[model samples]
Target: MSVPAHPRVTDVIETPVAAPARPRHRADIEGLRAVAAVLIAVYHIWFGTVSGGVDVFLLLTGFLITGSLVRAMERDGRIAFGAFWTKLVKRLFPAGAVVLGAVLVMTYLFFPRSQWMTVIDDVRAAVLYYGNWHLAAGSVDYMADNSAASAAQHFWSLAVQGQFYLLWPVLITLAGLVAVRLGVRVRRVAFAAVGIVFVVSLAYSLWITAVEPVWAYFDTGARLWELALGGMLALVVHRVDLPGTLRMIAGWLGLAGLVSCGLVIGDSLPYPGFASLWPTVAALLVILAGAGEAANGRFSANRLLGVRPLTWLGGHAYTLFLWHWPVLIVYLELTERVRPSLTGGLMVLASSFAAALFTTRVIEGSVNRVTKRHRAPSWSLAAGVIFIVPVLAAGSLWAHSIDQDRRLRLELSSNPLAYPGAAVHLNPELAAGLPDLPIHPDTTTVARETIDQTRSCNAVVEDTEVVSCEFGDPGSDYTIAMVGSSHVRHWFQAMRTLADQHGWRLVTMTKNACQFSSEEQVYRGEVYTECTAWNADVMLELAELTPDAVFTLASLTDRKEDEHVPTGFVDRWRLLDGMGVDVIAIRDTPRFDFPVPECIDRNGRDECSSPKAESMAEVPPFKDLPNVPHNTRFLDLTDSLCEDGVCHGVIGNQLVYYDTDHLSYAFSRSLAVVMEPQLLEAVGQAVPKGEPTLVDAAMTLHESAHS
Candidate 1:
């Protein structure tokens, strides 16, 4: 193939040199795909780390697709965007649809009903090729119902690739158009556009990964730079004809770096940031080395990578990637284990490979043959519609059923006689026949009952700005501020009942996974800088408002099977006492390593309670702390929440803690009976203004759910 010539250089009059042409076929690149797939599976299953294999795949997609688009644009004046997209849909959709269908069945069989709605949303997101954004949004939103990792979660990377395919060609076509008008080489313009993307996306990736690594992990913008690096390489790879010896050395060095990236970085650094350059640049080196034949074939990285087994694995790599995660997740769910044993992990790997081989040959092969016979875009479009519509329809129906079930459960809670909640602990009559009744806020729907499920009031994982929600009497003269993390916010239902009856305004200053403390806190092994800033803003807000009473948690279990009041909590209370604001410090609830509701649902509630001695100290730690604020009054309702030595999953037929830690809103409302008198005594208000009953509270909860 004759290469495109650069326009004449005015600085010196010389004949235009022809640019090197990219090869049409590279067996070594196919082998590289096999390596990436293996790394991804191994890291996910055995190491619990990101292998940087996804980054390598992103780079390869950028390189190969850009090369294909540039060639097409050079041959024809413009890219056939419709034909290109249709072909992509035909090639990718069939395998994706098959995997989704299999995942849906696996979820129904092995996963609980409560998790169905989340996985269904994942399915829809995958179908629309927006799974990355969907997962990113949910990952950061602490109160989101979709917190549990779904079987289809791995679709996020494929979704990123699909989005790249949709956008990259258009960018190159536009660059080519501008190049024609400007009378410059198209490759120069294309390279410039890709270079800009590389710099901008890399900067954004570094910023977001540092501040909100969880979201950055699945963010398309954070990952675009990896792809752009590959695009840049494709544009110039042919122009650099390196010496064979240099190519051999670069090849080996790049492969070694690529292999070591996961082991060295392994779950330590926030990803897709500058750290990602290790794997992506290594991939670039490999491609640069293999762009031409080596002087010594035996030692060339390309020669080793191009072995028949690797190339074969590369042929099935796409399906292999899709099959692995769902298989691992289903295996874990069935075994009731967090992670698989070594032998089990090997079994998972073998099963994934087998499934991938079968899927690639049967589903993908059939689609490929049909598309080959009928090359028209319409045929491809029809193929895509055939594969996608059923999954969407099934997901929609499943989501609707979940909503209906939740509404039914809420209605059941409206009757206190059936769902007495914490009241039964005090009233023996309410406890009668409770063992035979159905649990309200059904275990399946309990996880979704977070404060943010109904309203977006608290700051999310990455946000530093203060977001407050006002409940109870907004116009009341007396104010009761609920301040802290979700722990403090979880008690809002009980506080709301008190606020309404006593004519006191209720305000919440809360952030997800952040407590109201002055000391630095660590979350997920990183300094929660956003939480620190949020705590500062909250303190300033409290000083300005200086409410009559400031409500917050007095102690924490610290997830270490022990409870205590940290020195930071005492400092904040003292500051509040200085402001003449009375502090209503409530004891924090028990922290669990596993989801309580899920445990209760899987095994009967009788088998699910944790021993009180295992979760809390014999006495409240805050009561013994030195330098305790004189104005701060403590409330211990642990007896009302846990029975005799055990923290029960269900109290009075109402599920207590929703997930592992936060109390269910329905159960929290029921605790008003125990909470009201303590709150009144602490604030020096008349005891129990209107004496609100649990029945009234239940009705209020039903109304709130509708609202």
Candidate 2:
């Protein structure tokens, strides 16, 4: 061969072929972002369903960010944590800060003063990138104000994404190092690591989603598998070279599945659990179909996704995501409608698009330009500092002011003359001489007055255990058990007062939105499993404790055209009678379509009052029950709760209710004077005829307030 006229260099030397460079940008992914943002906004506006767009966004984030992180770890053997975080903050925070500032301003202008604190808290949570956890906690909280969605509620997804960005790089770096030590391929190890997270998180998600769906909806741990699924795909995308026909089929199927997911699942099912797989898997299929040579297929989704409109929408997707929720919520508030009208929805969509365009071009463009000019990580860090300081400072200041106001209101409410509460109801003479004092437990603090903060023994919505608390003469031989939903809980102030005076040990077994009943109950259209289980456990506990009497609500009121003793209540009463337990059943209080305190704030007390007939029947509804337990005693406080055929929001210079149906603690405390005698008689305690009455005893407090 050497003798063949000195071999040519090209024939003798074989040059090594270089691997194809990874794509710097993906238009198809951007188009998918557009689809997700639009779906979220539209579904929230009109569908009243969880559109799975949030889940899609989560998966996309993992796909978009994980590959780069893994590659960087493999290339450098370590991640530039500071530089990466700085760049991420620079990219995400500026627009977020602007949105927070806007939300604060809008809350002050458009929302009720009572709602300001919630918005402030949400803003703080969003700023700290813990909004998802905050929302998760609030979802399970009995006292959380959720009359309306907070403007920054959508930031929960952003907060999750922000958290993922912080942790994923470190995880990839760790995996890369571990791979080197184990003599394994980086991609293989990374995929396995992601698989472990996916399995564990998915299992947890399924369990929590079934057990406590409301809480699970916003829990980050329950949502991690969605992101890990994308990470797994990212690790192996280079190898996913599907047949052209298969890819084309996947592309169309994914697009269809993404569009129809919310319609199929709706809000009826617990979400971001196994249900979320529909959208997330669809997103993956689309991503896979567009990978490598598959994207070149004639009927590929790549052609449709690369169209100018979708790409343009994707460019503004982040800002659109930021702007749409606030716009929709504010619109709903302004319109005073729970959901937007057809025309209103269109207007909201247009306004959101316009605002997003402006924000992207002005706010985001300016921040991006500055960050680009200063390529150093330190400049990005400085920009981050600038972005965060104002939000923290402003939120802290606003919260401080509200706290001060709350403290002052709480202090003022302690003076009986300033807040006569139910004293006017106890003695009509006091009502005649009532001064025009400011409402007790001011509108902003009213919702918090349902019960004392120190007393947190009631089982939450998710808990099934028989959580009981003892108050007033816990060491007494005499025992009385208070049981029911929040209806019975709101009467705690009065019950505790009577228990202490009468030397009875008062025990409370209560759950929010759950009455003491054996009948199968439905809450928010799902089986009230916790309530049913709690009721069963409570019944067993009651058998062991053998309380002298069980105090609970006697009737149900819709605050509309209905007020009746439910058959379930009668059944429970009969069961207690069979157990040799006496039952003291108070008639249910009036419910309202609006918060009494908020109504009183917007419209004076008299104007906010409704006809007593709206909530009460001509006769006590329990009296008409077909089967009556001999040991059951019925008591009606309708006279004290309402007067002159009207149920007032504020009576005796006191807000009657903390919320729509829950009585204020101050009002409930004042009712102790009237409730004492009836409660004593029901428990077989002697009610002296000649001695100073409870009404007379309560007058002393009013007299002291005057002095």
Candidate 3:
């Protein structure tokens, strides 16, 4: 490996394989760190934006650590991975633990019971790492953007960096060993190997971001190129002895690039792709500029970055990053404000700085100082203690929540009064049995019965093709096709009993958060291509199978009836009408910002009911949007679902909602009494007169095909 004459902080750790390199005390790099932290905090708090600050951090992580690994391998013919990791734990863990412990306390005091389980899970993921994967899976879910932001979401990057820290050493060790076997210089082999990773990973980033941008955002595989770019630079930067004037100009431009990041590159774009190169490369320029003394001269921007205030901020940058996000998200949720006012933003910034300064100085710096003076085992033991305490506390919280939820579910099944799912509709006498407050079978268990969580034939977000699930009586040839998204899927439970009793087959095709629309819908700021593709296939299949009638959602949630129909609803209605097929368009269930069931669980029934008129369209959307008048029938079960111009959270002793919008399976099934009659009336009215009813027509076609 080619060696740098100058020693640096990353190089100075006394691992067994480490050379006796002294600390370089690079002021410019520290200054860059300060700038990065400020930009990220400013964007997160006030701008409500992404500024590519995480991109810079990824680059710096690879740049700083790779130099030391190379030096260690050269000095001892191998890297001492254990000592290297121990040094990182000492530098990173204490501040993170202090902030997480504080977040837990604040969460208990300020957050609602509805959000408790969410934050607890995030806290655990934050402590253990894998928060990024947890978040990626959630980000595209039907319920993803509906909830408030998680306080610990930024731990995703920290998790990514931690993963990189573990994996990089192994990769570098292998590269070094292979190079030795091949008689090639270790630096040449390492750079080439990392460069290959950079190209392949960048291509994967582009593809995944294009297809599924939400997952791409936090995916470690998609982000590998940014860190690999830094590794490649570490291999080549020492050889770049640029002219003093050119180096000075380059440093100034780099600083300008970093400052302009948010403005030049929009926050909406999927990142860690080609656009990320701008920030990573800009950070590289500054790192490279100050590689020697000439780039830190009066003319260079490195001199400005090396100023006292920035250096001080840079010194505590890690802690600041840890403290700022939770501080901002918790403050936003508690205040019930979307973003802060000018004064509030200042308070948030001041609060973050105060927390960061304390955690870093009292806990982190002290741990680093003590660990430096002590042996690796002492620091390792201390790190374990720091991490374990929070985990035990978080685990206890989770355990209690689980036990409580299970009790609630048990009460639902065992107690007749508590578990009167659909009885309010069956016997008017039992209507008096429904309790008005404090329902059992809490929101979490009810939420599990949602189509998304149950993972029945309901296709999840990742599905790209039609997955048809059959319900109802198989003995009947009278099939009804249910299409669109989860909004339509919730109707399954209501219609399942009706279909079997009526001797109709129900074929359902649904996807998560992806309603059928002729105009492409957006997911994570990109075209929901999978949705477009799946909808196309479903439309094609339904056209061929021309069932008795198609049942689907007829209105968008939270919009006036006349304003819109789903973008493609009209087109599909026309096609089906052309095939002499009818559509039973169900006016969608009402939506709420607060889940009524969870609200009832935490608050009383009186406080939890949503207004009837405001929750759904003032009129059915398809009523105003043109559709096949004779062939399309509109079903509004809203009356049975609501009463007294108000919607009850629990109807017929069934929790109305699993989450904010979707119907609980129990509640929807209960609606079958109210639904089946209206379903018959609407669908019967839509079938063209003189045409054989679907049952007669289907049987004739089958008999003829067999004959």
Candidate 4:
């Protein structure tokens, strides 16, 4: 792949491997830092967008630190790992601790007890540098559901960078030692190391972009390359000499590119993949332009960067980065709105800046100044650990507390729609009770056999059960498969009921967010490896069985436009349609208008009922456009599920949904009545009419389940 060419400036200066003792400051570098901070703030504030700006910062961080470390190593003939770790601890920990502590305090005050657990868990994950994994597991259908606004969500990036720092120095030192042993210069080894990591990271980026874009966005595996690019630039900085005029052009263009990246990239882009090169390359240009003899020049360096306001803001950028996101998230949670109007946006921005300034001056500044001047290396390290450890412990304890509370509440609350005389029926009693129903003897017997077979399907896959089920009969003639992501699994209870009534053998081959398409990878983290393999095995297995019918909720094709997931519903339909098997595509239900967990916590269970027609009255039409292709028959229950242009709370007096989006078992069972005609039509087969006995049997089963 070609590195997109940009205009270059030239100036030549040769210096020894060791940097001078004097502290070197460049106006352009500070300007670049200001540029980066502004771009990210603008992107988050107005766009709520994901761009490569974060990656750009990672690269700049790598370049600056690596350049300093290499020069220090050359002077001393050995790197002081202890001193390096101490400086990093002092630079990062104080601001991070203050912001985290503040966010926790705010969370305790405004957030509901129900939400506190997840917040606590997120805090713990952030502290442990594993927030990315926590997020990746929940990545599927992420757009449809709103997240509880949390300040700590943004810390995942900071954690990623911190993790990189933790490991990179050791690797660099090892490479340096090997280079000396082999008679290769340290600079050359550094260059090679950067190049190797960059190539591997890029390859990983492309693979994840195709398979698991969400994981690719967060995973350190695919992101290290951006930092490596900066490290490589640091190693070669002394070797390149650009002329004055070219240097000036490069500096301005670099600034222009940085600004453009913020403005032009929308929320829909596949981030941190190829798109990230924009900001990373721009930062590199700015760094290169400021290098060499004329480090402070008219075009390459400017008095504007050194102006009091810019420099002051630049000095507090760390605190600002920490403070801004949580404040915005918390404010949104309290207000119940996210997209602020002009005035609201300004308020958020101003408040964020004020908090950032306060935290920086009052907490971070004092700690850093005192630590740097007087603290020993071991003491500084201990202080950093002490500050971070409490937040992690608190977060973990909070998560556990929330889980216990929810379980207790659920146990105490009466089932809102539980019928007056309904009793839990065991399998043998249910089988015995079937004889009193008015139905054909043949159909009844078949239904009973199907019910017995499905008992094994629902059996929890323990060690022994797994082995037994592995070789269980992959039944033919009556096989019905349920396939898709976890969203589809939400409907399984209803489907299982119908399968029992119809005497159909049901099989489930589902993954959390994976589509049934033959794509290589889906989702993020190590889970994608398992999800992809599972999907492939399921598809191949299904092909062998050639089941009677395969059912799944309609594909969320709109996410394709945003590059959120690879395969669309139309693609999946086409693949199944070509296989000479019947495919049933069920339309997805409406998501709650507000964030579910937060709304439930705030308003109590009364306000947490199934979405009714009145609740969705204001939602725009065309938001749920039926975009599936003509080859597939789209099954929409919107009318049956809603009434008077608003979906009602019930199907025949049983609540229609389990949560905000999933259909309740009772409701799905009732849906067989509304769905029977369309299902018969799609199957292109007719119920054998004898004495109306089968219809009576089906209706009786449906009513029993719903009642």
Candidate 5:
């Protein structure tokens, strides 16, 4: 109720403000969907980057599904949950199943053997509608960008959409249940719940994107608000109407903004972050502008959007989205192309479009026809179950079989004669036939073998302080603190062997990407704030342990990109020297940008070697450290790993760098024969001499993995 307008305005009685008018038959929404689907597929192909189109789809899905379900419940007094869900499954699954099945066949025929297990694992996740989480766990991992890109990676959005389809209805049902119990309207209850989620999830997305972008990019929690924002618009638009002038402005602005969002945000942002509002808001305006027929005749965006071609694409959008990614991947792999040349990308796009058209028409239409013959909701529901169970089971069985196969390969690698490590360096004959074909350890294991080190001993990411894992003669009086990033940790196999022979206690206190230094280091694409703090904590702990000597790589390390000393190494050396802790600083090894196993598998040994000078950092030797005690010594071991200044991916029969930079455990262990003497000289300086190391030089441990 409004107070009577002030008497100053004259004595006209005021009336209640009416709600905006609602319109039906939004052909423009369909057109917007077509635009979004094309942008998403096109951007993914040509630019090889996200184009903010997925965010638009997420919102559109949220709004359409929520609005439809809410309207049905309101009109019929209760939802036909079984019928509703079955209809949705029928519309979506057949197309998705077609794509998955095709990809599986393609994987066997085309993808590298090393990628088989990873893609199969993703297949299971995709079928179960948790592909996003699976990807979040792997792709957003520490040093995650290093993993080989997967064809199924694009399934993450589809999975998010599928999960939302199941979850949102249940949420609405529960909201209705609560509303009845409290004697309030269901719409009010549902809206309140949705509004609450929007606030919480948006806040979480903002915070998580800022802190852990890898996780944020694929996290369901971080992306939920995008869908919810769409749902909210569905509710608002259903009850409100805008005048002609307003709709006209929104129509033109929304269309232009929708097409240009990718340009504004670019590829640098950790999105669906706060910047996501740009696309979602633009989509909302499009929906608003499309509410009813235009008052301005040809001026409205809806006129163009409602045209024939766009609406047609919108009808087949789901199939197109499903088909494009795998098609793109297969085309690239078969052509052995990277980031697709224009002609190749065009071929991929055309193939995807053709596949989409076929699946949507034949498989999708046929399934709908069969399901429609039965009007009973229960029959359709059972049919949906029958259709889904077998598909999911097939994925699970394939994943298990590949997992068992991988374990067998790893077990076989353990045999002394079977998998040589660095001995390949000593015997070039070992890598003779490997370079001519595709050979690799499980591509899935690359991250574990590289950054995470996969050993149960490494500290978790949450461990901000030093957490030590002991190895080799824990009771020994002489203690050696093995420290550095994953690069340093890769030497554990050799270090463990050396410590055993000398009766020395070995403690590993390293973190992912953490280097022992006083200078700031980068982590996850930003300044590595956590690494700097962790390094400080580690230095404090080493001071307390007062170990005989700290074994760590001392020189600046460079990979495919830049080279630099961890600016704080000098400060750290001075502090350690003052504490009487002598340092055994080893010159850092060369880093290869590409995976050695993958390279060696495809190319000859000669072709797989990286230039030594280009890969190595040019830091000064420890003679530059003015505070060095007489006991402190520096060692350069580059010659042992390189020949003629070119580093082989496989030296002897053993693979060198696992993925790109990190040495495999096997290769590092093979170096025990070489490392034993050098370490003996360094540790022998302080501790009473012990028995010599007994490593077999002929059977060098060669089992290594790469970055």
Candidate 6:
């Protein structure tokens, strides 16, 4: 392919050029590197409290490296793929290995055995370059209901970059080769191809951000354009030159933009799409300002950046990146807190810096020197394979183990309320009279009185198809509706038993994370957009049915510790009251403060075998002071579950909680003895004086169908 002549000289030689006069190392570029590094650290430590600054770093990386790669390819007829791979390894692996090794050792010492298994899994993923996908699948949920996973969660970004690095060079090479075959200038073709990919990827990123923001943020498909922006810069390098004043302006503007991106773009922005352009564009401007004859300018090439400390940091940036996150994670894990104190943060930072320096000096320098001396492509390839293979194997094994453990737990903890044996054992009082009560052959008929009352009182009914008023046996007179988030849904097994025994049709309206609130536009997926519109529509249906009582549970973890009532609970109470439906606020059970799987894996069945009394004593009862003026009654089973101020792990020989916060179906069903009276009191009803009938038996069921 014909190459265009430009004023800038190509710096390549047929043979190794004497490492060309090491141009005065520009302080500004180092400063910019320092800035990128700092932004990432701050964002993760505090602002992951809010936005993803790491994505900005990715964009900056892509722009800088892509520009360098394209310039190299344009200057030389071909890119030395072997050399490129070697440089990448030298840049990334030494520091990465140190971090991974440290995490593994620390994880063994401090983390529970169950968490160790996850560490093994993550390490494997980290090595194999698929950590992002693993994390995405895990979701590492940080919502009120779900807590964040591993401190190593930040490694997911590194994995994304690794994957990109693996594929990008190949893509660039293919594009170059294709351009050479055709009658196009290699630089122009490379530039055009990168530009096209950037636009397409950016478009895809936007679309995916709207539809599947979580995946979009993690997926390479959505992130490639950020890197392409840099490649585009490399191709057009010789054509554009900024004068001194403009260079200064661009440098300042770029720095400002980068900082602003972190400050302004909070967690609310669907990340790594158009919004990411702010940081990326800013990065590009800085890179451009540092290019050409003006590369030695004051702003970018200043002495501040050239100082020993900044230069040392810039040189070890890759190492520092690897070491920082795990240190932060380990610190948080030991403390069991999200926001570390300033002193703690500083300690973590100091430790990470120390580790980075040691790893770079001892490990990275040695590896680079050894690899450069060997210069054997076969050895490099073999080493790469060796490094990656165990990671892949370990990841697969860990994934399998996790799946197996989940299945085993599920099997052992299957909903006991659904088991006939458990039901018989759970309520001997009800079971004793079950044989004497005559079973009604049919009870499908809806009472006319109930139908009339529902139609007159129900205000939110939008569809007749879902809202049905049906009569039970002539003796049956009650109705019940189940409502709330996924946790409420977990109670369906018990709800079904109660509904069937009482001869009342069950009306269920539930959505995951959708608190049954009147407020619209809760955040969903990746964006702060409206929740599933159908959820609101379903609530309207439930309101129309106007059941005798609405049953739902307040999430224990969802409540801020200082606040006794969950925010969702407050919102939901108002909506239910407005609908004129009586509310049964089932108090949430306690969650194990630590990771459940870690405890289980380490302790085996004994991990979950604690008596309910012992468990309840450790976790205090929620003091529910009603915030609403409506007819709400507080139910307290804390005293019943806890004897002598201590809650037992097992209640009636069944595990009280299956995982951390969720009540075991068997345990929940057993609670019928303690709960039945409170339920009656809450509904302002008296229990029949005679032997318990099917209607009375129905009141005893307390298992959850939704979690």
Tens-digit per-residue lDDT, 538-614, candidate 3 = 87888777788898877676624423566577677777788887888888777676767647755766677777667
In model 5, which runs have C-alpha deviations exceeding 4 angstroms?
1-23, 139-147, 292-297, 375-418, 423-456, 459-463, 559-567, 604-606, 617-631, 685-692, 696-707
Model 1 ranges with Cα > 4 A deviation: 1-22, 140-148, 293-296, 453-455, 687-707
Where is the poorest 10-residue window by lDDT in model 5? 8-17
Instruction: Give the per-residue lDDT digits (tens) of candidate 5, residues 372-483.
Output: 7876766556545565676667767877776676586577666544455554444444445333321223444543554444356665454577778887786777898888
Question: lDDT-based ranking, best first?
Answer: 1, 2, 3, 5, 4, 6
How many residue pairs clash per model? 0, 0, 1, 10, 20, 36
TM-score of each: 0.92, 0.92, 0.85, 0.70, 0.87, 0.66
**Model 6: how far residue 435 lies from native, Å:** 33
Candidate 2 per-residue lDDT over residues 332-429, each given as its tens digit: 88878888889999998999999989988988788778878988998887877797789889889988887788778778877665566776765556
Provide C-alpha RMSD values for all models, in order.
5.7, 7.3, 8.2, 12.0, 8.5, 11.4
TM-score of 4: 0.70
> Which residue pairs in candidate 3 have backbone atoms (N, alpha carbon, C) closer than 3 angstroms, thus clashing?
518-568
Per-residue lDDT over 612-678 for candidate 4, one digit per residue giving the tens place of the 0 to 100 score? 4333333323235455444455465556655455443333323344334555444454455456566
Scored by lDDT, model 3 comes in at 0.74
lDDT of each: 0.81, 0.81, 0.74, 0.60, 0.72, 0.58
Q: What is the lDDT for 227 in model 3?
A: 88
Error of 5 at 605 (Å): 5.2
Clashing pairs in model 4, backbone N/Cα/C closer than 3 A? 9-246, 9-247, 10-242, 10-243, 11-242, 11-243, 151-326, 613-646, 613-647, 642-647
On the 0 to 100 scale, the lDDT of residue 495 in model 4 is 64
Residue lDDT tens for model 6, 382-458: 44555455545644665576556545544644534333222343455534433322111001111111123233222
In angstroms, how far off is 684's CA in candidate 4? 18
Model 1, residue 437: C-alpha shift (Å): 3.7
Q: What's the residue-level lDDT of 377 in candidate 1?
A: 96
| Lowest summed lDDT window (length 10), candidate 1 | 8-17
Candidate achieving higher lDDT, 3 or 6: 3
